[model samples]
Target: MGRPRLGITSITLVKTLFLAALDAGAVYFAVVLAWQGSWGFLSFLLLGAGGVNFLLLSHKAYPLRYLFPGLFFLLLMVVVPVGYNIYLSFTNYSTGHILTKEEVIRVLTSREYAPTPPVRFPFYAFGTPEELYGVVLWPEAGPLLLWPDGRLASLEGHQVSDTDADGIPDVLDGRPRLSGRELLAHYGMLQALRVPWENGWLRLATLREFGYFLPQFLYDPEQDMLVDQRTGIQYRAGESGFYSPDG
Candidate 1:
């Protein structure tokens, strides 16, 4: 042998730190899985992570690392999905009903419709371009103040003022609002925002406006059917996993 390595060498220290970080992430995900009631997937994750950790730590199991990567991928990608598909075969799983009854109802009821002559609100952002603190919606009705965290506040409480008199409020709660090119940087966060409006929601419709929308379908649990508000047609869930028009 050329040289013998010490137990607590720099390479060993780096390995220890890497493993500790990996374990921390595993614990965090394990807690999330437990909270979400994903027990089977959680068990697989715990067992797989535990095995990897043990194999890497124990000197006797060093040789297994060469074969471990392939085995891990095989079980995770191929075995788990195959097992889940087999489990689904016993139930009424098909194209339309891939999800549970409650899930299907939730999806249908969540669909939205944009009203004719849509009320488009011009809004302005507050805080740094990288991250937004709040926004002011200027609809014809009135001014509305809202935060990215999904909380709405009164415009009066924010000490609002239009410094440049550009129609869009320039200052709110002591923060100068972002405009033009600066506002574009906050696109990722703003796109996913949904604010409750009337009986439905108002969402980011374009770069310049937030559009008000209404619920497209109303789910009646007592009748187990979805009623289309626009067409006034009722569609009932059938055994074939599709919602056919009620006769």
Candidate 2:
């Protein structure tokens, strides 16, 4: 009699689904990198992803399936980088000599400009110092519930009571409103709190307000400099990296 073949198991199905998801994500990311003109990193990503697919899915690579992953990452992360640095050592060490003028400009142009007349919203505090929550009133968007861990949600949908009808809700869900003095205790933790807004951030500007900030760095190709919006300073590429008015 011929040997019986095993049917597809639950574990095998889950593994197949997971691998498919991983490859799909890899393909999407590779496309993004290609569009961004990051060919060097894209090549590395493709090489690693291809190797992983071959090792995990191919019967021929079964022996090295587990071994290849660890080995491949070690080479990609450590060996390849160290070898590249060693190769760069053979070339001139000076930044101006090793890097092209455009490359220098690209490195110095890395800055973000916070828009003028920043978006500022008056916010009310809720919960407590240990676990804080806030409500920001935006003109167009109404009230937004801001959580301590950076979660943002529409306050209109959530159950909140306006006890005094002061426009600001007194109690959001079970968390009671906190007074300005009570909120003083939460000020330290609140400082670093930021919520995503307009591809930038909405962060605490003061105890009563939150403000929006975004990337605004403008690079002047003719001047070969990048302007800092905050300080209104222009910076050019120096021998080491950047030459700024502050320097």
lDDT of each: 0.82, 0.75
Candidate 2's residue-wise lDDT over 154-218, tens digit each? 77667788899877678877788888888888888778876777667777786788878764556
lDDT for 80 in candidate 2 is 88
Best by TM-score: 1
TM-score of 1: 0.58
As a whole number from 0 to 100, the lDDT of residue 230 in candidate 1 is 72
Q: Which ten residues in a row have the lowest lDDT in candidate 2?
A: 105-114
Which pairs clash in model 2?
Answer: 112-216, 113-215, 113-216, 113-217
The best candidate in terms of lDDT: 1
Predictions: Cα RMSD each: 10.2, 14.5
